[model samples]
Target: MACSVATHNTKSNPPVTTTGSDSDSGINGNTNNTNRLNELKFDVFESITNFAGNFDLDPDQNFYKNCTNLSNYFLCDQFACKFKTVDTQKSFSSIHFNARSLVKNLDAIMEFIETLHFQFDIIGISETWCNENSPPLNIPNYTLLSKNRNGRVGGGVALYVSNLRSYTQRNDISLTNISCDSIFIEINQNHGKNIIVGVAYKPPDVNSNHFVDDFDKILTTIDKENKLNYIMGDFNLDLLRYTSINSTQDFLNILYSNFYLPLINRPTRITSNTATLIDNIITNSHDLPVTSGILYCDISDHLPIFQITSFINDSFQNDVPIQSYRLINPLNIENFKQDLATNGWDDAQMS
Candidate 1:
């Protein structure tokens, strides 16, 4: 719903694995903060956001003073990152990337995060060949979630968080399709939303529509449970334009069926290789207000994605602008099937 397409290809050697359920304080589930979740969400009812965070008593006389608050803090420490007009002096903060990748310098992942200097709540990444037990680790104030492909080289994901405590991280290990989708759930003190985040990657050879079905199923499961969801990932297909197999209609089916909307301010180039926009950040749009639909470029082959929406300020309203987003979509697959059947796998059959 956020990023569409670009031209880039990043590679890593050997497969890697990241495992374990997350357990962070302040944001973990079962902490008994249910009463405050909606308090932090946006409200057209109020002009000022109801976000809850650590409001600095005496914010530094720098640009960052506008960024930080009493209830929450920066997720990254980067400057180039576009913020919600909060702090100015000290740059925005974001979570770091996984330490391991199939290619790039082994430390390229961490090095990139450190250099950017931004605070992030969630990061949807690709090009990681993660194996079991060796998941990217030791990151401060965050948790990880992802699905790693078995026979692939560079395909995996990680979802990190700050302020909110993470509950569990699960991988969508599927063989029929070439997608490593890692999903996680976290309990936030503010807003009291049960965030469902997934890090997904679909290679060109994979059935993009099948991946889309898997993605919609996740949202459906989350919605059935009545959990407010926010999903991020690398959905190899482009949403703006449509592929006969994976077109705009395909994407709309999933989102519209689930009554969801695209998160604002997605990435133009999520892949690190070329300038292709394949990353995204999508949410139940009706729940948000004043969100960013797109964002700027960065040092990596793929650009970073973000979102910023207004929610009600329950007991805890982090007002965490989903600033960075990872493009991830599709639907109406029946048409694709009929089209493929009526025609052939290739275009010649149609005539």
Candidate 2:
């Protein structure tokens, strides 16, 4: 069976609720308010320094003054004033799911993505079960890059990259000598280093040793490119069994030796009796800050996993002015007063 994937965005707004004065509304209203507040707690906090409104009273009096309840007030205040500093770092976000068959769940996947508060940069799918004869799969505002299995019926990998990003398919890397189903693309970032994104799927029936050797060759090729890279997909090897399974241990060892780190530590597939983490997103950029986890979606047997990585531009970091402050000691205060009294006032008067 194939797995399906979906995307997630950072949510900032609180859920809206209606209020009533009926006696019966007390318990339900309170419960709804508590649930909404809990939802707001997970919202991604963003900088409000550049917001084009008065930081003093405009937000409080004009924007949040009419907030219906405590949840609304906290959500508005959190977005409007919680963060004071601007975040200049750029980020790349990607989501991967094993869609056992994409065509059947395309609508559900689209609906799920639309519900996310933020959009992902790349959407990867494993086990697409698509071939040359299959109908074209498309997503709005994204370009699809897929590698379908030739003779097989159930294994394939695909990537849907946002049209806003400039990318080129890496045929040379993807057209390997092995039977691994994969697709590779290079994202060209204007302000930061380019990122190589690849998606692959290894069938459960495939020989572990052969699959690992083939996958390693691909990893080695990308590693030699020496760019920030993320390889995501369903490897069909349970990472939870790393310590117990020899093949799983070898798979992880190869990744670590290649300087790649798997971001997902939890299980991606769960049933009544067993849980397994066969789906993953592994990256080589260890220095960058990254957040990754499995999303609780039930469109398929496999849960969707995602990664959001903040890439710091060295040039931008170098350009940012460092704030240096004078010590507020008595000597500095007296010197400041003496300078203020003695300095020429021509420039100040002209201004």
Candidate 3:
């Protein structure tokens, strides 16, 4: 199904690659970067009931350190592995931008990310130029989970989910309820609770009331399951001019009544004649612990919006009191045994 694909991390699996050229790998003078990325391979596994992912760095010292730095976006050890300690809350960064056209700006976006001096796990993009016909974009260490406009052009949404955590798209939630594009997914936090992430793009001409009603349905459906919701994207609504009885009041009312906190208070899109706060990030749960603002990057007309949220450890660490296991079925048992037996056992022990 086009809805989803899952794979277990196994030695037999081949490396995954994108179709087009690797001309803009963000790393300079590294023509071999794509091959190196392919070498740092892993996979995701899912059963009928649950989903999980695991990957180990290759032991080559230089390759391992280079891949780790590139994969984690140059984050310090404290930021990337914050979950290693129990009872310690670590902040996770998420970014959102109205790309105007994603294809043309992909390289700039990657370059911009590399300069951030820290790591962020999720990015929501609106007006991605990709339709059903566009080829896949191969961003190393990140997965592009997207929803293209089915019938029209110019409007679409995507989530650039980092490979650092486990995530599954919510195919059950339909985006056709409203006249826009969106991608919804459930992020498995490794604990019993999952975080619901919704990235949406609402056309400027769509009626605010209808949009509010449809959006309410989406939230109510997710809320019924008692999941925390973080919705971010470009709605094209001028929230700065909001009032108790304005044209966009119903949408604001729904958000306010649902306890959804709007994180960006400044203008996101600025033209020569106008400045509007159309892009935003909102959430209903305080337990997620988020702080946010607008970034002054010049990648697009819409300034990038960002949020930092605290999450417990959600990686492949087995000692976190979560159940995780892997079954080994070596293809060549005799060779494996002989290889193990041939090691310098006495010398290693004496050392």
TM-score of each: 0.53, 0.65, 0.62
Number of residue pairs clashing in candidate 3, backbone atoms closer than 3 angstroms, sequence gap of 3 or more or interchain: 1
Question: Which pairs clash in the backbone of model 3?
Answer: 7-44
Better of 1 and 3 by lDDT: 3
TM-score preference between candidates 1 and 2, better one:
2
- Cα-lDDT of candidate 1: 0.42
Candidate 2 per-residue lDDT over residues 72-145, each given as its tens digit? 21121222232223242377888887888998877788777776545688999998988887887899989988
Which has the greatest TM-score? 2
Which regions in candidate 1 have their CA more than 4 angstroms from the true location? 1-117, 132-137, 163-166, 170-179, 188-191, 243-246, 264-267, 270-276, 293-299, 310-351
Give the C-alpha lDDT of model 3. 0.60
Q: How much lDDT does each candidate structure score? A: 0.42, 0.65, 0.60
**lDDT rank, highest first?**
2, 3, 1
Select the stronger candidate by TM-score from 1 and 3.
Answer: 3
Of candidates 3 and 2, the better by TM-score: 2
Q: Model 1: per-residue lDDT, tens digit, 1-351?
A: 232222122333312111122222122111122112212222111111111111221111121212211111112332334343433221112232322363443345545555545445565556566767453454565555555656655666665555444355433323235445454654433234555555556665666667677777777667775555666656655543332334445665576557564442222342212222355555553423333323222334443455544443332244443333222213334444555577545656556
> Candidate 2: where are CA atoms >4 Å away?
1-89, 175-178, 313-351
